[model samples]
Target: MVTPEEIARVPKVLLHDHLDGGVRPETVADIAERTGHQLPVDDPAELGQWFADAATSGSLVRYLETFEHTVGVMQTHDDLVRVARECVEDLADDGVLYAEVRWAPEQHLREGLTLTDTVDAVREGFEQGVAEAARRGKVVHPRQILTAMRHQARSLEIAELAVSYRDRGVVGFDIAGAEAGYPPTRHLDAFEYLHRENAHFTIHAGEAFGLPSIWQAIQWCGADRLGHGVRIIDDVDTSDPDSPRLGRLAAYVRDKRIPLELCPSSNVQTGAAPSIAEHPIGTLAALGFRVTINTDNRLMSQTSMSREMSLLVDAFGYDLDDLRWFTVNAMKSSFLPFDERLALIQDAIKPGYAI
Candidate 1:
């Protein structure tokens, strides 16, 4: 059995995490104060609780409302830098040895920072943060996945920017936003450009929407992975008390090996899952779909990798084998180079289990 303490000490890889959504409230308050941005709530604890309450209320509209404040606080170069650095530190402390953080650069251009400047600022912070972690003997490495909002245009430009920065810590591309009515096909040209350039990207789908969204993200837009993808369960059936199995869509996703970044707490908060006990992650993992656990919005979900693992431990009674499979799934789905992925599995993950 994988004890909660053992799970915390297990080296993990995170493939689906949102940079803006993960910001600590204390960081948000400091940025709000320095930039004179009026936040609805000033106290970090209160603000954090507000987000937790709003997101977990089971309404997608209410859940998204929490981000308007986080986006506001992230409008300046300094704001971007601080959040990016702190995010790396926090992930490192949570036992994530590697993570790919994504956010839309165009959304942060309100306060005089150009699109390029915003991307660079975040990348600069990532570099500085990784160095600082190394100084403290932490083996955390992070990569950026530049995103372009699905509703707004400029995805192609962001796609090009991501490819350009492939040498400078940027690893891939992504598109995030409200899923309903904003199909990833709206960004086909951008994905086509990324495909032509041999760059990697993932799309937010099967979240706050249904199977059609997942279909468009995979078949139409060519996402290498599916973000949230909880609604894929809609296509499957568990009506039977025993031997519940995948539907066509679920089978195809598993057969094709499309990585599903499953955020249990976030899914519960957004009503994608009824609760941790009902989350499909355990079932999907057991069924051999490439399921990777993540903290979609740590602050809003009031979760970390440790908490997510702990919930699985208690709810699903998963053991170390389950944890190893989840870690391997995340590592394989990561846009990091193949050699590095293998090295992490061999050096960090395997040795941790030997303890």
Candidate 2:
């Protein structure tokens, strides 16, 4: 059995975490008061519980409504920086050594900051958080992934912004929103542009939707990964262990080595998967798909990388080796340069698990 303490000490890599979705409850309260945004609950603890409860609506769109308050408070340059800084600190405290925190810059323009300024502000915050973590004898290498809202028209513009900041702390790009109606094909131009620039990106597909979403994300848009690709299980026939078979889409995902960023708690909260035990991640992992676990929305899901792993351990009986495998898969699938990814796995992740 993998103890919670051991899981806490294990170095992990996170590929699909949201920036606005992981703000500290106390910080949300403070920002709400300072920014004049009224939250449902005044106390930080109750506010956090409110978010977790509100997200339990079992609809992805409804679950996202909880972000209104969090995003409402995050409008100014200072607010963005503070949220970004705290994101790193919180993930570092949870034993995440490497994380890609994603958000939509266009959403933060309410206070008049330009998209470029928003990315720059977040970069500064990440640097500050890294320094602070180092001072506290922890090492967390954080990267940013600029996400374009799929239901909106700013994807091409957001894609351009992401490519412009590639050499900086920005590592990759993504499209996130209600995945059912707004398919990845809606932003074909953005994905094409990203491909032409050799930029990496992931699409939020096969979560609230089904195989068609996953197919388009891979076949049409050329996504490097599938965010919450839990719905890929729909195409998998696992009734018989001896005769298990995968549909064409699932086979392609596994044979092509595409990474599936599976967020178990968020999947349950959004009704993508029934429960941790029934999550497709177990089947995908057993059958050799490059499955990586993530915390899609920490506040809404009320989870961390540790908690996600712990849930899987409790449900699937995964040991340290399984945890290490998922961490390495996430590190390998990360948009970081290959050399850096290799070093983190060899020097950091492997050693941490060896303990």
Number of the top-ranking candidate, with lDDT as the measure: 2
Kindly list the per-residue Cα lDDT of model 1 for residues 1-355, writing each as its tens digit: 6777888788888988889899999998988898788887899999899889888788877888888889999988888898999899888888898999998898898988988899899988887788888888787889999988888888999999999999888899988888777889988999999999999998889988999999888888888999989888887788874787778888999999999989999998888899899898877877788899999888898889989988998999888877888888899899988998889889888787675
Taking all chains together, each candidate's TM-score versus the true structure is: 0.97, 0.99
lDDT of each: 0.88, 0.93
Task: Give per-residue lDDT, candidate 1, residue 308.
Answer: 93
RMSD each, Å:
1.3, 0.8
**What TM-score does structure 1 among the candidates reach?**
0.97
The 10-residue segment of model 2 with minimum total lDDT is 235-244
Deviation from native of the Cα of residue 24 in model 2, angstroms: 0.8
- Model 2 lDDT on a 0 to 1 scale: 0.93
**Which residue pairs in candidate 1 collide?**
none
* Segments in model 2 whose C-alpha atoms lie over 4 Å from true places: none
